[model samples]
Target: MTSDLKNRLAQEAQDIGFDACRICRPWDVPLVPDRLEAFVAKKRHGQMGWMAERMNWRGNPAALWPDARSVIMLGESYTPEHDPMEVLKHPGRGGISVYAQNKDYHDLVKKRLKRLARWLIADSGGEVKVFVDTAPVPEKPLGEAAGLGWQGKHTNLVSREMGNWFFLGSVFTTIELPVDTAEVDHCGSCRSCLDACPTDAFPAPYQLDARRCISYLTIEHKGPIDEELRALMGNRIYGCDDCLAACPWNKFAVEARELRYAARDELKAPKLAELATLDDTAFRAFFSGSPIKRIGRDRFVRNVLYAIGNSDRAELRIVAQGLVDDADETVRDAARWAAGRLTE
Candidate 1:
């Protein structure tokens, strides 16, 4: 029976290292199009113009594949062993997001999704497709719809069981399966996530302005950051976790079971001075197999210099000054800003 098969699929997902699994119909996420339209209308996605490019597919999963009847949403936790917020106090060290401190989750999660998808097809004889964070699927909304978690005020999915520290992956299939009940918001009157944003990226409750987010500035953004927001970035050189760290629900989070997600010893609290000294070759080698590699040398260095400017360590001025005459204009601009701040 379909019910027994769903149970097997859930068991397989757990055995494959996913912390949670839930199912829902493709049409469950009906609100995505309008929500996405409003987010894009305000030009809030910053330089990630790709958000505006895939409206049809992202807005409605049913439209992506007309015959697909169910969406299997899986959650994999990567909760850190240490307090992620602790690094912000040490301006001398760079704070990469816990998510980026290990191997790229996209590759790891996608491979797992494909494995589960293959099992579903072999068990049920249905065509299937898999997606991690890279695709145009409205994953957060679909996640909420699948009863895997609810979209918290910070706009990331939060589960009563898994908290806010999980990545979502989806498997779409033509086999119709029983769906799980959607989760409800449990963030009653808690402004912890909103107040935690260093850049005040949230314009209102349950909304975000990606333009001002440190994560966007350091990662997706290709050029120099606005000087106003750069100062707020502090030592966070990659993705910012202020909101996720502030979520009180994370107390119940399960630690990641996958060894691939464990933080590398060298990345725990990298020295900003050491990071600023990386040339293109060194940057690539240092970040190989890590998600930070995608940002490349120039952008990564630009972020490092921004942290250097925010760092009150006067000795770090020389590190910034050395890069002031570098080939990349953006890196030079960031270095000049950092040198000026340190000397001031």
Candidate 2:
């Protein structure tokens, strides 16, 4: 009966739009606690202090909810249709991460997870809890334990079938379902992801120092960025995809099934000058459903100013000049730096 229920659950997940689904025990990720402690001890998480706050719950899924006997890990692909790196060549424009170019995945993925969880409860009469990226849950490690994918050298889950461009969601249930075998590392000798990092965020294979990660810098960071890292940021205004895009396994990546995951034309390669002009109200409306909106106007513009500084385009100097005396000190600092770089 448990085996039959698990089979139906996987089929239900696929019908509901998940690209892949697998089951694992909540306590399967035994290495997470020590690895997480080491990462926090070294101060690698940067401004993401929430990562350190949860302690036991973040590292151990069983502790998070003692009733959860099984973790149903799901992967939803958001693979970009075009080369995500193409926007970098147009320095006058800003490069937003492929995932942020459309609707926010948290809302989309959570809704799907809820539906799947509801189906599981209806089928087998067990309580369930769902999580996207928002919680302290180690979704990637759980995904790896569930055979969704192995955590690649980039420290992100990579599936031989779906590649690295997928989002992870989990449904924790009280039902004792059959678990799949953990996926083994298939990366072999490939260092493409490590070498492609613009900020050298990886300290070693299967390790990431979020302090130097462009994604953390542009989104999670609030204050003025380090001058050296700012220059290396290039035109990337939101999140960086260098490592994800550099993976050779992307050759096998499947197309995103959801139409909402497709890039919006306006966000594809927005002009830095136009983006720099956005006030708080306009910024909110412009990025209404985008994950970029969570950073707020000041940080977003700060990232834009940094991109403008890296562009080496004299025409955008005035754009930065306009924001030099802005209300936010960080934005003002970014503007001054960008304006000075353009003058140089």
Candidate 3:
């Protein structure tokens, strides 16, 4: 596709409600190998072995598809109407990650990216493949290379205009499209994200120790959480947002245009006592089509137990005690931990 055709595609994408779009040439992602090595060397990736699996392929976007010429990177905002931080104040309530508040973004983003790729094919007479987080591509770096955003110190892509609440999707095409010059960092002299972490997850500027990260603990960490970090987790039952919320660039973020990202009534601040009782069936039914479903009842209950343990409310003891003999060992461990916290 010519430069004019790619630019038109970007404009058309915006008209279709895509917040940001950029075209990046497939090339060696130089920084990713060191970053992955740093993460693995420190055991920061934790139990997510996939991060350590592929080497050459993880550092080169072209490795995923040698014939591909450009990566069309897209961003969709998922900002909430109300302050997502506000839910953390209510210790009795569970804080679901803002991204997973309503609907699954994977299906939503992939559908739109595919539509754009189809348009690109019709205009350019070429083939394309769509990817939404499922592929091994280094999306944040590609976004930076494509002028969509800079990868912030938090290691997530940040656009001066979109903040960190956006989801990334890409379409790799054989067409040699014009590239958008990369974006530069504007995080100048700001350390709000590093300072705000409850568990001090950021070990250094631009690097995160995922082991200490609450999001990793809640979602990625398979076993019971480290006891020291449990109380610091506050009401966050799924993922933490201290780092993302602290970025000043977030002022440009408008509320999510799609209703799927708008907070649901029951999800905003669900009762810990009520959630603690969810069986495997109830868990599936309640979190159907939601990202939380991927974790299953065992891990979700484990997190609830952590929250219950942090709660000073003696009434939740009954709920925690009931799970002391849960079928999942992780849940049972968390229950014992909760029971100990109340008794203490």
lDDT of 1 by residue, 77-137 (tens): 9999888888888999999999999899999999999999989878989899999977789
Supply the global lDDT for candidate 1: 0.92
Please count the clashing residue pairs in each candidate, in the order shown.
Answer: 0, 0, 0
Per-model TM against the reference: 0.99, 0.99, 0.97
Compute the lDDT for candidate 2.
0.95
Model 3 Cα lDDT, one tens digit per residue, 1-344: 38788779889788777899888888935777787777787888888888878656667778889989888889999987878898888889999888888788998998898889888878778889999988778888889998888878787788888888899999999988888889999888888888888998888888888888988899889987888899888878999878888889899986678888888889999999999999999999999989899988999999999999998878888889998899999999999999889888
* Model 1 TM: 0.99
Model number with the top TM-score: 2
lDDT of 2 at 33: 99
Ranking by lDDT: 2, 1, 3
RMSD of each: 0.8, 0.6, 1.2
List the candidate numbers ranked by TM-score, top first.
Answer: 2, 1, 3
In candidate 2, list every pair of residues with a backbone clash: none
Best by lDDT: 2
After TM-score superposition, what is the CA distance of residue 119 in candidate 2 from its true location, in Å? Answer: 1.0
Question: CA lDDT, every prediction?
Answer: 0.92, 0.95, 0.87
